[model samples]
Target: MTDAIKIDVWSDIACPWCYIGKKNLEKGLAEVASDEDAPLVEVTYHSYELSPDTPVDFEGDEGDYLVQHKGISREQALEMADRVTDVAREAGLDYHFDILKHTNTVKAHELVHFAKEMGMQDAMKERLLSAHFVEGRHVGRVDDLVELAVEVGLDADATRDALVSEKYVEAVRADEDQARAYGINGVPFFVIDGKYGISGAQPPAAFSQIARQVWAEHKEEAAAV
Candidate 1:
């Protein structure tokens, strides 16, 4: 039996490149899945907020906030987003940049933690990212996020109650703490097999190459035993 390769991904829902990174990683996995010697990959998404103090209903444009926080010119921010959008399109993802609603994602992360208990973490992660990036859904609200959880096969009522009660806040916080301990300063950071760390939104080919290398190393180690 092949051992499973664990992948820990740190990202935020509001992050545009994180969505692209997810698509890139999926493509990489699809490529590896067809190979006979590929090790099984088990992915777990962690929470990392780009703007934890962002209001639930932030007023004005997201670009304005970027300008205020990062002190980058509006043109620079737009250009950066445009570049990421191009990358996303190449990865076969449709990004609705105009409709994206920026807000605090702490509750959304909590919902993902709750979904982990139900064995729907991947589905929940995709849904949350899509809801924030493409669907213009407000992920900061407990009721809205509960509906998203229902779509991902979680119990909606229980999720709603948990969100309102802030049940998994600590779990989300723990992930943040872990990210800090690992010196992760950006989103879309990938930790392969808990040993190798790959940062940024790397291409699918890059991920596939790493997976193949890791699988080979595992095989050699096992054969020597």
Candidate 2:
């Protein structure tokens, strides 16, 4: 096992629970920050589109999309959205369900891969989620993605060129294929040490406990080696 515990997170910008899971993971890390023997953790965010077929400029709102895709009623969709917003607030995330522009996340995922290449993956992911869920920004468009990347200190022209040329499209597809191999049909899935899989938006205390358990096993393995 590696010295630092490797965490590969599969999430999408359009996924509300994914953002919550990201925050919970950080909170868990904070809870274990003072542990002298805790293994250092390194996270890599992988792409997983919640709605791959969503068009670049979807004409409907999130409620409509949910009704069509998930076969839920409009009222049910709205209720789910409200519940998600309330849950997000408890995790310190402001979710604007009414204004969120529902659209394809392929371009946003590509931008995440581009940001990963530039060592700004975390910033880019956060910016994209904030733009999608909180600010109602169009995450599927090149111009908006470039603007978000620039806001996160990435070079604007380079980002635009990368998007224009579709530099990281293959990387996004590869992540999706890997998720398939793992039989993962959800976003915000966490793969710890490339072995343990944790699904859904678990609580911070759960993540903290898992981290300690993983760290203990890691130490034992290192000693045996």
Candidate 3:
């Protein structure tokens, strides 16, 4: 049996549920860690852009973007944002959709790839999500992304150079291609053991249950082998 259960998460930085899903997954991991028989957990975040064609500097706020892109009425957009805000709050995130800078997340995904090389991918992901959902920061711009990378203790110059040079652009695209191959059409999609697929921001208990089930299946296969 493998030493750890690998989890590959395909999500977008601008995705609010991705952030909430992240928090819930963390909670679930913590819960499973308390179990003596649980396998070690390893998570890798992959790039998935929900709005690849969005402008780097969108003129309006998140609601406007939703209304325009999602073909929803202005009132429906507000209601949707409010519903997500409450859900995010329950997951311990402070979402400020009113101030969110709805922009393209391709550059942000590239930065995440750079951080993964530097062993700071999780920190970079958390910072980027918070910057967008809670802090209302522009995550699409190179200068702004550089600042965020520095905040996570990555070298400022190297971060800037990587993004400016488009060093991780291919990595970002490769992840997207893989996502398509997996037939994943949504953010916060979790692939457990590279076989079981879990969608959406599931609660902590659900994650714990899945982890235990995977471990059990591994044990059964090992015994048969």
Candidate 4:
């Protein structure tokens, strides 16, 4: 609604920077008036698969997959991972990429859409990212996804049923289509009020500044009308 600035983010559960971006967004929200002002902001997570072609049960390590899919040498992939790991640390995230089991996150994306239907999308999205990146849990499998949903206070049985029927797959696809239409080719992309586009895992201050600016503009336009 125009009463609140809506932040729509397209991200993948398996992306390290996506989790960091989420945290930074939270920091930004908190920076504006003691976290109470967060109610003025409405955030929605959208689906964007970084590696859609990845098999559900990928048989290799993250470095290997990066080398093959990213067209980078094994050493370069490791270096990149290490560099990101350091960045993640700066965000107060203890990311252990070496133990991370990377796989296709399509099913996980569907699970997030299901949570959105149930009004638990935020919790589900955070839990899924933490499960994969920090806890090293499997996200591509239905059973695992259900477990994560249950942890987020969603009904396990209902989640399992929805997943089995592939109920929210279309929602996930719609998100991907919208992302492409926006010419967004990266994860952790944030759209504020459907007008301002902020790409990548920008600093918390950037998010805070955007939120304040958007809220002011929204107010100004409303006042003018």
Candidate 5:
């Protein structure tokens, strides 16, 4: 049997580019799914908070947060959001930045770790991103996080308990530590087989080409062994 390709992703739920990159990467992986020779690909998501200092209940909208965070004018922040919204639309994502709740994502990250234990990590990640970007829901609170977890087929009470007790705080911190060790300063970063690192939201073709190349190299190395 051919070995699977490991794709480790570091991203935050509040990141717009991370969602775009995820969709594009999925599209890229789909491009080679029908090829019998293609090796399996396994994706593991890690925690990376773009704005760890952001408050759980920010007093303003995304533009307001951006203005303070990026030190840009309100006009410039809105323009940036508009540009990202357009790009997100092209990726089949409907991003409603106007209604987005710009909140700290540490709790959301912990929820993802809980889902990982339940074998629903990817679903939780998707839900959190959509909740934050598309649905404009609050993800920084335990109540909201628990609801999102339940939506992904996780136990509600258990989810609540986990969040309240901070069951996955260490796990989240560990992922962050690993991210720092890797010198990763950005989200939507892809580490392929723990060797090749692809930064930012790349084109779908880029993901397809790299996956195929990695699988081919893995096959060659196996044969040589």
Candidate 6:
């Protein structure tokens, strides 16, 4: 069996459930680590914008946008946010839906690509989600994103140059293309070892179970070979 398992995650920073899913995945990783025979796992976060065309200075409320896009009532959208907020809170995250300023997250994903080049993708992803959902920061701005990258141990000037020059734009686009090819229609989708697909912000126990099952199957396949 391979000693390491690779987890590819497709998500966007503007996605509230993505943050919750990330937390749940972390819980699952911690649980798996407690198992003596658990294989090592490396995670890579990929770009998947929920609103690729959203303007930088979006004027309408997020509830209005959701209502318009999904044809759901404003009340229903609010209820959905409340449900997601409860899930996030259970995962030890604070989500301020009322204060959330929704905007295009393409630039944020670009920053994630830049961080990946610096081997700080995980830190950058966590910080970007926290900044957007909890801190209500403007993640679309290049300067603000650079500041966040620096806070996560990335080189500030390099990140600034990358953002200014639109470096890694192709990488972000590549991730989007891959997501489309995989028929992913939602954020927080996971591909485990390029073999199994898991969707949504599943429970921690569910993630743990999948990890264990995948690891076991990989081991058995390797033994047979």
Best by lDDT: 5
lDDT of 3 at 183: 98
Number of the top TM-score candidate: 5
As for lDDT, the candidate ahead, 2 or 6, is 2
Clashes of 6: 0
Clashing pairs in 3: none
lDDT of 6 by residue, 127-187 (tens): 9999989988889988888889888999888988998898888999999999999999998
TM-score, cand. 6:
0.94
lDDT of 2 at 90: 94
Instruction: Rate residue 203 of model 5 by lDDT.
Output: 89
Q: What would the per-residue lDDT of candidate 3 be over residues 116-209, giving only the tens digit for each residue?
A: 9999999999999999999999999999999999999999999999999998999999999999999999989999989999999999888989
Model 3 TM-score? 0.97
Q: Clashes in model 6: which pairs?
A: none
Model 2 C-alpha lDDT per residue in residues 38-152, reported as the tens digit of each score? 5689899999988889888888887898899999999999999999999999999999988889888888999999999999999899899888888999899999888899999
lDDT of 2 at 211: 90
lDDT of 1 by residue, 165-200 (tens): 988999999999999999999988999988899998
Give the Å error, residue 134, model 6.
0.8
Q: Candidate 2 vs candidate 5: which has greater TM-score?
A: 5
Writing each residue's lDDT as its tens digit, candidate 4 over 1-225 gives 448889999999988999999999989888985644343899999999988899888888878989889999999999999999899888888887877888889889999998998899999998998888788899989888888899999998999999899888899999999999999999899999898999999999999898888877877787888
TM-score of each: 0.95, 0.97, 0.97, 0.95, 0.98, 0.94
**Number of the candidate with higher TM-score, 2 or 4:** 2
Q: Which stretches of candidate 4 lie over 4 Å from their true place?
A: 35-39
lDDT of each: 0.87, 0.91, 0.92, 0.89, 0.93, 0.89
RMSD in angstroms between candidate 4 and the native structure over all alpha carbons: 1.7
